[model samples]
Target: MTVTEISRLALYGYQIPLNPPLPVGRQRITSRHGLLLRAITDQGEAVVELAPLSGTDMDGEPIDGFSRESLQQLQDELTTLQPQLGSTAALERAAGQTALPSLAWGLGLLALKLEGQLTSRQPRLAPVPLIYRLPNETADELVQRLATLPRDCRFAKLKIAQNDVEAELRLIYALLAARPDVRLRLDANGGFSLTQAVDFCACLPKGSIDFIEDPCRESADCEALHSALGLGYALDAPLNAPDFELSPLPGLRALVLKPMLIGSPAKVQALIAAAQQLGVRCIISSALESSLGISDLAAFAAQETPDEAPGLDTLAAFEADLLVSSGKALCLELGQLPLLASWEAGC
Candidate 1:
């Protein structure tokens, strides 16, 4: 059998503007600037885009807690290590020494792609169920965005902990009442008090919510609230920096996996295995990376939990899709990733 060897590695940096700017927590994400790697192999090529949340927001303010890993580091590593990364085994070994989880993940995926092990089942490129993040804005603007929701849309995720509590509540009520059949996920980012979380969860008509994420900071508080309401919540920030030794919690409905931040590809696989063993659902989401990141993200999510929609509606917020070599702003569907990568690679 002919082995698909790594013939070349191409590194790139891009800053794609975001329209209407996604406001998550305090950051108004106006643009995405990150590093990507193209692993050119005998078979074809595989793309990996790093999704670091530490980039500056639209206001040019630094996003809190971004790691020290930068674009230059990834490029330098690829350049210095190019000669050594000639085979799948070599790339797999390289991933362990790399400090940046995103970089390691990229190499790991490239190896898998070249070896024809990226997927075990099929050659199909299908769309994952995506949950749209409702922007935290005025009631009128919220109503307008809500109006665009597809008739068949089954899930919606919203952020809370607002200055205008009444307005936020009104929007939540509207979403719940309007689409009783649709399950909603509220993310407070651990910024709320237990009382506030309880109040917010209480407002929901029974069975309208799928889960809440990081409602409060303390696990004890969250566990108590879970006892009170019997509603489950997923851990986001906590899971990002996990020890991978967690047992099942009563209210841990799911673990939102961010492949880039979670360590090497092996670590991500272990985390998923652990979560599945605990009977917890797995939801893979991106950190707002460009085409490279979203491409692998959709692949990973589809591989793990294709039926459950990952949080990938962030694609709709971009002003331009930098993945295209022509650099035109076009519709980016999951199926178009390979073509987009080839275009970017100028192949």
Candidate 2:
């Protein structure tokens, strides 16, 4: 067997526009921008891009946290490890450090392994389901977009917060009113108080919501919120804790996993196993990563029976996604999001 090693890492910037602004509470994002990491193999022809999740700032300002400085530092560190490790397994072991470079290197090695097992000349990849952030003014516009989507698209997501509970409720009502058959999920980003979250859940029209995600900040309170509303809840931020333990919340129906935040595929698989044992739902979502990251996520999602819809529809979050939307579905050819032509590194 020929042993290949990582040779170089290149970072690129991308910006992609959204059809409508993505709003979470008062924040509205018009475009998506982030950093891309490309890893060159010793084979010289094989390359894999590693994109981590870095979304727009509080004011919906686009900022690339995966900067050139950070990427170069990560690359240099990984290059130094290549001689000692000499194999992907050793690199995977080093990934436990929780450092950015280690995480990037781990992801790069994983991607390289995936590239080696090419099942097809052109791999058939699924489009990530996007959850549009609807502004108060054009909330109806989002509904219209959802209503127009093809019947095959069984999932859509909405962002909500405690500040404007009534407006969000009204938006949800309008969406359900427009598309009675579509499945709907909500993400509050832990924006609501326990009391307020309960009230909001109570106000929701019965069966209108599929599930509510992280209505409150804490996992304990998340369980409480679920009990109070007598509805299913999903955990997001709580699972990102480095030393987090799974306590098995009764009403908790799902767990949203962002690999960038979790930092390891092993951890993700562990969470999935725990969630499965506890009868909790599992969804693999994105943190506004580029196609490189999205490709990894899509592969993960495909491998699971996601209980709640995964938050993989982040293509619109970037100014350029390597994939394209074919009606309601995303088109991926050879791990590239074709819609984002501007951000194509190797494809």
What is the C-alpha local distance difference test score of each model?
0.67, 0.59
* Model 1 root mean square deviation, Cα atoms: 5.2
**lDDT at residue 318 of model 1 (Cα atoms):** 75
Consecutive 10-residue window with the lowest summed lDDT within model 1: 338-347
Q: What lDDT tens digits, residue by residue, belong to model 1 across residues 108-136? A: 77777677666643213333333334456
For 11-85, candidate 2 gives per-residue lDDT tens digits of 444555655655533355565554444445555533344444345544655433222224345445545544444
| Candidate 1 off by > 4 Å | 1-3, 65-68, 119-138, 242-244, 324-347
lDDT of candidate 1 at residue 138, scale 0 to 100? 56
Summed backbone clashes in each candidate are: 1, 16
* Candidate 2 segments exceeding 4 Å error: 1-4, 7-35, 42-86, 101-137, 305-309, 323-347
